[model samples]
Target: MTIQSLGVGSGLALDDLVTQLLSAEREPKEKRLNDKEERIEAEISALGQIKSKLSDFKETVDEMRRDSDINGREPTITHPSEDKDIFTAEASNSALRGSYEIAVTELASGSRIETADAAYTESTDQVLTDGLGSTTMTFKINNTGDSFTVSVTQNMTLAQLREAINNNENNFGVNANIIDTGTATGGAKLVFTSDVTGAGNDLVIVNDGDRAELDSLTTTDSTETATNLSPVKSATNAKATIDGIPVESETNEFENTIQNVSFEATSVSPLDTDGITRVTSTLEIGYDRDGLDKKIRDFVDNYNKIISDIQSLTRYGESDLEEDGALAGDSMLRGISNGLASIVGSSVDSSSLGGLFALGVELNSDGKLEIPTTDFGLGTGDERLEAALEDNFDEIAKLFTDEDQGIAVRLYEMANEYTSYSGLITLRERAAKDDKDQIADDRERFELRMVSYEQILRDRYLNLDQTVARLNQTGSALLAALG
Candidate 1:
């Protein structure tokens, strides 16, 4: 009398009936949850895609809003001859447009000093001849305490002494070498060169120990005066003449000599026909028209890309055969697209040249930016762009970089409103995620309800099953009594 299975005791298809009832109860609610989850997921995905694109657009506009990208200067040099590279020059945005005649007379040189002839008979000769243990010698730059010492042992030869001096860790730019004059009169001479390049900065060696033989290597006395070594070359400054005016620098690079212009003297200019007069090269500073033009074109292209993405995201299907966009009919997306167009088409008051139209950038009928090749009233797009770059180059920077009214500045701020961490798009995405989580909780509750409903249906069928079984037994008993 206990129903082990739904149809076992009743002789009816109760299992199939129970299955149909559960289906009727669960299908509608489950379908609603599934549809909602799919919609929320699509919306979250679309929001993420748009947020990424907007961030990229923001980065591009941020760079365009910088003055360095808009106002740049280009330096052009014309050497006196194609074969000779006399000098190279560079100019900054602050440099004025002008041409100058530059003549490099002399290149800066460091000091060189060599030992006297017959200083040492051979490379194997010991440095400390009079002393037994060792002697230390100090090498210094003239008039400064900057010096390094080399310890010469009794067994240290002229060659080894040169190596020791050259290999010392504290050695400050002094290089040592031996020049064999091939005779005793100019025997193996130890030469020293200093990279210290000013006119008064000279290299000198001093004998720190009381070894008379060490004096052979000393270039200065205890008072740091030049006394022994012969001066091969004196430290000299780089000399140049700009517009027939003289200028000199301790190093080869001359900075700001010509108001915001810096030039490096590579080599002396070629001599003219007279062999005494040095030829001059031309250095010209002008606005970087090409660079500015490219930046303007990039801005137009990038803006158009954003517009295209927005159009795709917010567009509805044209027919029943096509599926609608994920963000179709979204007011927020429409507002973003409209806001972008408004800012781009608006005028900026900070620049005298006005907004993007002055630079030949225009919004087309399709809500995208373009630099048309067609000719209109003032000039063609290329012509207007070229004129702007040539005449109002600095104004172009103001139009895009000014804090109050720059187009790029305003656009960036607008994009930031939607793409920032606590922005509208992020908040919307988080809300969609919350809804999906709620759907999961609903599904769990729905499963629990199905379990309870199944138990109730089984319990109600059990009573009818017992009554039918008892009635069948009584009818059989009455038939037997009549027989």
Candidate 2:
């Protein structure tokens, strides 16, 4: 009764016709917008990848700028005798390269004290301080006169006192623990150890109150009335000699005793037992050539990786699919590539080693940097690098670390320009995102217009169908009268 049977009156496929017309108008615009969106997305992805590569390149450059870089002076240590556990040493770049004799006479030790074996029992619920009136226990370290206090309260167990002392905020350089002997005669003993090692740094306990319970916990040396605690070990300073010159330290580890050289006294020299009392160990400090070589090689490898990524992204190909590299024709990529190449190819001023090419790094036919293992008829490549490092070491370091014209410094600065928060890459990405947003807005408006156009087509067709039905009815009535 309604428009369901209207197709017969109109003699035309109205629904299909309207659909075809609307699709024809919408399809092309939608396809164009979708293609633009995809291109912008691809560009954003490409920028992210480029930024990552630049950051990696910057890391290598930063290493080269440091004084501790492998390209700089490297120190190597050699011990003359094997199995000399008496001592071990490390030399820094600041250390003068020389040979020195060392002797370890004694290793430093910490102060240790144990409470009298009868002080505590294995029973957890037994309160040792029940009868002990409130008292103040003071601990001093290093004879510094700086002390920490522990207030012993009534009804406190031996375990509780240990925890209170350990958890005290003011307590420094001391640790307390409860040791259970598990024997009837030796129930439990509280032990205290000085965290610091050295001759003058000793743990001293003093009881301030008249409480006998607190006085019993102090060592005999600190209090005459103290008989419940005994000193098991005395704090002692480490003793050693460099080239027969005596040296003393609070700890076994000796620092700056030999001009930028630090060492730890592990055990007494074996020569002491033989009655020789002479140097037990000899130390040699020198330049590490192999270490520097490995570092330079790693820097070259990281540089090449960055170059390869840039080349891949900017390359052009014949086929459509193969030619779709996101940054193929990007001007920003071109500028970045040119800037890096210029910096690498430039020379540092006031340096005997002019540039990387003179010191083993060379650009190949493929536009990538490579370090050849063997010299290919040119005396200027890998062989030159080794000779320069061995013969003119200072010049090689100056070439890469020169403050004004160093290649590493310039390259690091250049990378920062593109990778920084407000850099070129970030700006380009922002522009691309804006373009995508505009395209999305356009698509939304187009869809809305199509919806309104579709309704117009449906209204016009419905009116046409009704008008054609009325005309058919009139003609049938006329034919009936004529017959």
Candidate 3:
């Protein structure tokens, strides 16, 4: 650590200067090595952050797998408490010839006439009994009962009036029909019928004339809602069964949750219901199946990234010997790699529909896992995808979460138990904070020690320089004195 001071011309302490300079210069190198280590730790720390998010997202994907309708599609869903099993085909064979008393309520207000012809009308049998003009609408009362007429001003169309008659088949117990043409008599006439002999789904229409009743279009009253009234066609004909659920709808619009698959029928029904008519509807879902897919993709992408990063850590420094370094021998990464390799090729059990596709899954040349299906034209399928999904979803989910089969298991283990859903990111976050803290601390100590070493070296070198310079000066003085 000594420094020759002759180079200072003997005017200063050269040894001290050199020692200080040397110590200072050498110290940063060691300090820099420590800094480099901190940087590597930080890099690892950041990767861990992304890893934690992927684990949470993985659990979400697993849960949705059990609930998805399409293989990898999302849904739009709103759980509103409307009514359940509200369909009351309480309608039967007698539905065509039912009657009951009616009390109409006008939504708007004004001076009104007790429209004999304009009063309560019906569509049932209208087209059948009357000709095309009968299509104007008519209703015959099967049972007048004791029901009185509530006067109103609004004119009821054959369609509107027909709906009014059948609105509460179960509640009011009435069905209405109109004759297609004028009765053998004259004037348009509306008819009301009772599906049940007693009076279920039947009604009497009261106008401003002598009250009349026509159970079988007998034209009991001359002052009915309409006279010579035509008949409107019968009620709507709707019947369908999407998968196995029967539906009765006027149009193609219905929502049902059956067989654990959310159905959004639209203009189409997959199965025929023989006689039961259903509405055609378009099925739609929000943020469910497709959401889960995005979630799964996130998991896979993060997984691959972590694996690649770990790979680099093991064989760093461009040396053959580095190939056997820390990451290269990491058992955790090896386990994860093997786990991924297995899931990519696992097939399904196909015993259900006569082993429709004996081959469970196929890998396309594009590296996509193609699920085998029947029929292939999308009627459920040539082979039913629905059937396969029903039979195999549980097994598919196992590959993502089970200790022996799931990616999460190996991924969590690779994370050194730092990633988990049981406890929300507590361990992981601390690991990150502690890492950054260690880097800062090591950098600080390294900087301080480097400063000290430099000072010591500088002092030694300066002292040597001073000593050498003094000897030269003394030799010069001796020569002068001898002269």
Question: Which one is best on lDDT?
Answer: 1
Better of 1 and 3 by lDDT: 1
lDDT of 1 by residue, 55-127 (tens): 9999989888878767889999999889878888888779999999999999988899888789788889877
What stretches of model 1 exceed 4 Å from their correct place?
A: 1-34, 115-172, 176-191, 204-218, 221-231, 426-483
Residue runs of model 3 more than 4 Å from their true location after superposition: 1-6, 11-39, 42-46, 49-53, 56-60, 63-65, 68-327, 339-418, 421-436
Task: Give all candidate RMSDs, comma-separated.
Answer: 4.2, 4.0, 17.1
lDDT of each residue in 107-177, candidate 2, tens digit only? 88888998776766753533435565676788887366657989877777778888888999998778888
Error of 3 at 356 (Å): 15
The digit string of per-residue lDDT tens for model 3 on 361-434 reads 33344333344453445442313434444454334344444545344444445343435544323454565567
Between prediction 1 and prediction 3, which has the larger TM-score?
1
**Residue 55, candidate 2: how far off, in angstroms?**
1.6
Q: Which ten residues in a row have the lowest lDDT in candidate 1?
A: 221-230
TM-scores, all candidates, are 0.81, 0.85, 0.38
> Taking the candidates one at a time, how many backbone clashes does each contain?
0, 2, 104
Clashes of 1: 0
